[model samples]
Target: MFPIRDHNPSGRVPYVTYTLLAVNIAVFLFYWFSLPSDFALAKFYYTWGVVPAWLMQGEGYSGLITHMFLHGGWMHLAGNMLFLWIFGDNLEDQMGHVGYLLFYLACGVLAALLQVAGDPSFDGPLIGASGAIAGVLGGYLVLFPRAKVDVLFIFVIFFRVFSISAWIVLGIWFAVQSFNGYAATDDGVAYLAHIGGFIAGAVLVLPVLMRRGGAGFWARNQGKPPHPAAEYPVTPSRIPRVPRR
Candidate 1:
């Protein structure tokens, strides 16, 4: 399942989100050509991506920051960008451009540390903007629990888009990540980073949320947007073609 868009639109263009995307793209381009040799690319990731053991050994501490821009593959990059584009604008709107940038960096670092706490001895380099984008999801959930997020759910031959409350979607996402964390013994995913970043986003947004007048913000905005919503043209489903059986 994937999110196409959300009914809640931001009041302004999210400069921070756009800049984040650009930076990720640029960093990927710099390393895209280095993937022909797995060992070479792995070395690059080891130097830039978060390596729990190295950090614990008091080295390569910069990966806590650089790792957020490194992604494992195209699908990984696309998925992270989609979530950031959908949920990030709202948080950026609330926090403003500069504030959101710092907030994002902080979440990325904290999430890496949390991943270390989950398995400090693992040598695999954790890469992807997922942890930071997961943070944005966290902030969005807390600030607008009532907002509508349209998610695409697919089960084999079936595909459906459902509009649900933000809380329900994000809450379930967090639960699944945590469950995966508990179930996996090693290296399948950095699910704990996702959980940690989410918690960080929720906690970090508290001050910004309160400054906006706590419940009064919801009262004025109806927990939605103050302007017309952004519409994503619904995709038409294709009926499977079969010979007259």
Candidate 2:
């Protein structure tokens, strides 16, 4: 199951979120297409992406922040940006542009540190905005547990969209990440980073929630977006009709 969208709409335009999307896409395109060779790309990633061992050695300390802006491929970039777009606007609305930006970066840094702690000896470069996005997911869960999120399920050719509670979607996602982090033996995916980022997001949002009246806030808003839900029109399919002979 993949999330298509959420019912919660931001009160104001999420300038930070939009800027982040554009910047990530632009950075990925520039590096992905302009790199001359695989070796050169590897070198570039080594410089920018997190290498736990290198970090432990007091080198590449900047990778924690740089890594989040880099992605492995189109799918990697697309997936992260999709999550950011869906969850980030509401967060930006609540935290304001500057505060939300700082929160995002803090979660990302903490996530990278946790990943490094998970296996400080591993030297492979870790890249992607997933850690930070996972943090956003955590924050969203805390602030909008009752909000509706539309998830698209695909099984072979069968396709369906289901509207479910944010808690369910985020809960399931956290469970999967936790299980994977425990069972993972390979270095390809940084499940630990995802876990760490999620925890950070959840914990970090608590202060804001408290200031907003905490349980009282939930009671008042019913854990939904403060603004009216945005309506999107479903477009008709454009398949051409076969003329009867």
Candidate 3:
């Protein structure tokens, strides 16, 4: 199951979020077309993507930032952008454009550092904006824990959409990442970076939360977005339901 959308909408357009999406897509297209072979693509990734060994060796310092824009495949780019699209605007709405952008970059860099620290010897390239997007999720959880997010759950032939609380969704996600990171699973995913980015995001947003009145913020908004929660018309699923034998 994955999130499809959220019931909370930002009060204003999130220009930074949109621009980040466009830039990531553009960068992916640029390398996808320019590179003719898998070898070349791998070489490009090594140069731009964060390699724990190189980074720990005090080299390729720029990869910490550049790596956030480099994605391994279309699905990687799509998944990260989708999360950003859903949760980023609200955080941007609270933090403002410049501040959100800085927060995103800082989270990405810190996440990379944690990943490097986790396995300083790993030589593979780590690429994607997931770490930064995870940061947005972290901030969203703190600011709007009760916001309703519509998640699409599919079990083989059966599929359904469920509107659940933000904390449950993000909380579960963080838990899974934490477990995987601690287990040191070889899934080629940077779970450590995700963990670090999430913590960094949550901590970074504390100032904003305090400005809004700390616990009073939660008391006032009741952990939901300040604006009226959006109501989506329930539409029947297109898939035909099969009768159980």
Best by lDDT: 3
> What's the best-to-worst order under TM-score?
3, 2, 1
Q: TM-scores, in order shown?
A: 0.91, 0.94, 0.95
Q: How well is each residue in 1-245 modelled by candidate 1, as lDDT tens digits? A: 77888996788888889989999988888788756887889899998998898889998898999999998888888888889988998888889999999999888888889999878998889998888888998999888887888999999999989998888998999998988888884656789899889999999999988998988987887776555766768667698777896
In model 3, pairs of residues that clash are none
Pairs that clash in candidate 2: none
User: For candidate 2, which ten residues in a row score worst on lDDT?
Assistant: 225-234
CA shift at 139, candidate 2, in angstroms?
0.5
Residue-level lDDT tens digits of model 2 in 144-174: 8988899999999999899899999999999
- The per-prediction CA RMSD against the true structure, in angstroms, equals 3.0, 2.6, 2.5
Ranking by lDDT: 3, 2, 1
Flag regions of model 3 displaced more than 4 Å: 236-245
Name the lDDT of candidate 2.
0.92
Q: Per model, how many backbone clashes are there?
A: 0, 0, 0
